[model samples]
Target: MDPASHPEQLSVVNEQVLNSADRSVTAAVCLRRFLCYGSESSTYSTKECPLGIENALSLMQLIEGGRGSEVVDEVRRFNLEGRAVRPNPGLFTLAVCSQHADCKTRQAALRALKELCRSPVQLFTFVQYKKELKEGSGMWGRALRRVVTDWYNGQDGISLAQAVTKCKHRAGWSHQDLLRLSHMKPANDNIALVCKYITKGWKGVEEAYAEKDKSEDLQKVFAYLEAVEKAKHSTDEQELIHLIEEQRLGKEQLLTNHLKSKEVWKALLKEMPVAVLLKHLGKLTANKVLIPGSPDIAAVCGRIQDETVLKKAKTQPFNILAASENYKRGHGKRSKLKWEPDRDLVQALDCAFCKSISTVEATGKRFLVAVDISSSLSSLCRGSSISTVAVAAAVCMIIAQTEPNAQIVVFSEGNLLPCTVSSDMTLMQVAGLLIQTPGGSTDCSLPITWASENEKTVDVFIILTNNQTNGRENPADTLKMYRQKSSVFSKLIVCGLIANNLSIADPEDCGMLDICGFDSQAVDVIHNFALDIF
Candidate 1:
């Protein structure tokens, strides 16, 4: 279909098509710099291959066909030849790229990242700044970090998941190696050529490439190349020609429009079990911290599992500098209830009132117990999942083993089931209680107030939350409610599950014992902080 023949949306359609340099777009920009600077230095960060040079020229031609002047700001922003040594490069990178003109910033940023590709010291610095990279970032940062971090660490510049898909089995690459391959690189050496140079040297791709299943795709492609090389010794000319053709066709398929292998996508989706693509898409993106280009993009990305469609999106290239899906998870008042997220729950139980390791042999007499309604925690109901339900139940069971005489209460939508905890029965039989109801409004103070007033036997009142309130809008009023209850009672631990970025205006904020990420090893974090109540 000729783009010119379209009556409407020609411009829009063109925007969807990645610039003609294909998958090697990022490498191309780095190589073109050679023409201007006339040198490829590993230390200075401007190392471009011949193929890279060719791809960059093609990208330049596309931008020039529109408005060349728009790209000037892009060159200024992403230090195309400069270094991002700061704590949060993603934040600065996105700010510079988004407003600097579309494709212009994309290529320039790619070049800037490539320059730092070959240095081990630079890679270590990235790991040091890991928190800053994730804290306020979007999906773009994840994408770039996945690739760049691997390269700096001397890995193959791709993600682990990608590696699995490419090789069809785990190869020798570590997590860092996969991350390195996920992005492009600029160094010109083979052993340390970075992604840009490697892609160019191997595939004649001048531009950078981002495959949906980058890890797996690259490994599969590379393995074929290796096999063909070895086959030259034994395979005849006719056989060699057949092998070459197969390799060429395989390479085309590897680099072309197919996205993640269907098998891999299904495996990921299977983790959700009962959740459909519609529901789990948002869940996975939220957990992975990926944000689609627009709300529409988020919506589409969340719903579609189509490899071709996802591949196009892969080419669109997520800017890890955008707003993350996790920014709002427990943003102030939502997860502030009386229950822990999965990891936190595990931590609270794993440490037996000690800041050390706790296995099944964790000493006698459990000192802590956490309980919530089946509807409140179960995935079979609303706003929760089966996994979380299992997590909350696990907390109670851990207590039952250690304490033997621990008291546990399991609540459903309305009925509350109280059980005596003993080593014989660990997991609660609350699976039968999952049910729908008029969603009950929760109070930050109610559960704690009740526990403080009633459980005089408890050594420490432990509460877990996502740092949000259901109806308690006023933070002070809620705190006052707990304070009044606590005035008579002394022992209490207020733990918050910071599912997202929970900004505490005061470092010594009232009642903040600890803040845990969603995946923060629950038992480990509890023990690490020495806050476990025996």
Candidate 2:
């Protein structure tokens, strides 16, 4: 049976704290719950497919039945009662609302996420889109250097010319900061206008330039503000910020792509219903097309230089109908290959990625991670962690799988993707060696029981997942078998993530010292969790 088919044969707990409790206490409680009951609450009706706002609760309740119905109702009751409770729930709820088709729901989610930025964890979300932080050796670098160089200089006029001169020798800079800088305006007699703008507060800069707009972009924005001001009802700052960012997305036209992708985006845009002024700005920004995917594609090409070798790999395209066709477009090709792909195409490809993503960066500490993608992982793609999951998965790909020279193992029902150091192979190249497929159950014991049945002194066996797990037979059965076999060594560690309030039995099954949720600094968590497991 699919391991997911059962309530993971695990124990469970508090489940209530997520909604009404203090975030700090809730955070701590949630972790403890996972440690205490890490596996419990098993039964038929206990499990029900989750839906809407009450989703995560339903997942836990699924292992329990008529009581499960009670669980669902309780979750809803908690929701309504807590209407006056924690505002953070809004942050958690909006993410799941992506599944909803209405614009109001989506807008709410986006707004909540934006508000989360004020929190310390804001940097986690920020890291994903930050392709260019204030780094050196580029135009942006020059721009920043320019600002730092003259931030204290010229008590008189700090012209754009001087700023440019400062950055002329630098190589890179922060695009976001630079963009913010460009929007700052000075007062008529404001000595060192930049400093003046900064001192007078952000409103001062916007107000100073609010009326004297030079570009069409600024004009549309001013008009939007005017419209909003005319409205009798005042909107909150978050609502205003959401509209502005929407305009930014529309302006960049980043969503312009395939028919399906475009249609979905358009529908979402309408559902979001930004002000006409915001929509207008989006359209204007959309029109200013950036260089089409060239530099990014070029960088990718440089990563994989073997033309002949890469050509052979494309012999298979899982999705493209014309994937198998021999296609190339280059100076040295036989028959001048038609529509062939360029190198560094992994960005678009759904291949297995590892943690060593920044090959260009320095070497990182090495470690091992063993994950059971058998079930439970559905949590990563659900709840407030969904977006975080994708980003985390990408990071992991760079780490674990990126090292073709490292030893790696992936186990799931009757199958395993395992590698050993051979004379001709390096573990760093392992991620490139296997294709991942989600198996139905945590039948990992089948192969493990076979391999270590007679061996001793084995390395670590870490299970990376959301703590809830159910097996066809019993995960415990495998644990017993594990103990019975193995002439050498055995150490087991289970990393349960966001599994607020887990339940477990036979304390021995869980080698972890009652840990729950995830702490990013733990090297094991860093190496094992999906790149998307943020």
Candidate 3:
């Protein structure tokens, strides 16, 4: 029987053979099957393709079982003959570094890595792995040093220096490795300069080279280094002064640049003059730019000293939905910045939403904030480490704060559980509480059904979800029924945290609005819809 034709049957057969026959023979058969069918399976684009890095890991596991010496020899031959490596270089690097790999396997893995390092991108990976996995290990370090030396010898000095710098800064190369490479025979003056700048303090470059002989080459290098230092200091001081001056002038460009900086934008926000701060607070709030390191935005909101600014802040068409989508796509991960908006700032932002409601005073309206805490919501938002649930919680907190009569509910499957949200609770705290709530199949109708069954009169139903709704009853049908029975005009706003084509709103219903993401503008949308003003 051909095992290659049926992988499932092969798995079962392999499992039975392992239990009934010699372990080494069973392993060898498994290895051969993996090499043939496994390699082909890895090329398949389908999600069900079983052969992957895990398969390579499993093969290594078998080799480590003390009976697969032949398999080890086969792998070494694969490396020696330039045959297709079972796993790609990145996965192979991770696999071979495991403690489970025998000495023979490690040697073969290193050889394969050496070949892979011929590509500049792969060389960067080698440097990263050296720092992450095998730091200070003599064997791995020597291997990498040799590969780098060979690469440097073949490449132009300037290109090689740029590649080294890129690897050092972006790939997390250690100073020690960079220093060693700087001293290699093929190393150019540019490479040495970059290495020195990274490894030594900028101010102490002269001190580091104080003892070197006063050759013409050395003198020229010293002059260039000093000039570079002067230029950097001059640029920094000028930029700082220019930014301060721009803030004083109440220039919009300063706010634009600040927002574009992402996490570091907080620095600009904090340092801006008070006049600039007050002038741009509305723009900042409307854009939903979370000012880092300061609660100034909140302070401005609490003071409400300028009613016009408050009005603008409340009504600005800020897209929280887009921001939430960007967060999910992992935009904030590289910045390593946590989303820790000040409590007052959060309250103030929520208040802006509250103020947007024209029919009733924000403090007097009855709000039902339903957040989907389904299992999928726990996953990180794009470009951000912050979970989708966390963003939803923040939105919920904002909606709840507008009215003292607000009720927050977390729904999953057919369950609707009330959430205890205090005004003092941080977004993180709200998120933590929501995460603790039990999750099941998504039922967007649960919250609506609960409110209708209990005779609850909700002015607005704010549902925060990824729109992957699977429920016994359609949410749109349930919402329609609730609106018909209610004496008060109710609005349904679906805030999608995930970017998908599917929407839960009825296209024909004017009362039902679909907003993508947890944007601050959602409150305005809700407020406008409730009053029939839009």
- The lDDT per prediction is 0.33, 0.33, 0.51
Candidate 1's C-alpha lDDT?
A: 0.33
lDDT of 3 at 7: 58
Query: By summed lDDT, which 10 consecutive residues of candidate 1 come out lowest?
Result: 315-324
lDDT of 3: 0.51
Where does candidate 3 stray beyond 4 Å? 1-364, 380-386
The C-alpha TM-scores of every prediction are 0.32, 0.31, 0.40
Model 2 C-alpha lDDT per residue in residues 445-523, reported as the tens digit of each score: 4434544543422334444454355545444455445545643223344445555544432332222222244432233
Clash number by candidate, in order? 56, 87, 15
Compose the digit string of candidate 3's lDDT tens values, residues 1-534: 365875533443344232211112233333433442232111211122333446554465655664333444444333343332233333333334432346664554455455544545555545555544443554344555665566555554344433443343435545445446644554665445545655575655566666766557545545544433443344343553444343221222233343443333444554444334533443454345645344655455554433454455433312322332333343243444444334555454444433433222353567888988776677654323446786677666666665677899887886778998876776567878777555677788888899999999987787877655788887778887787788555667776665433467664444565554433333444554455322
Top-scoring candidate (lDDT): 3
Which wins on lDDT, candidate 1 or candidate 3? 3
Off by over 4 Å in 2: 1-355, 358-441, 444-452, 456-459, 463-524, 527-534
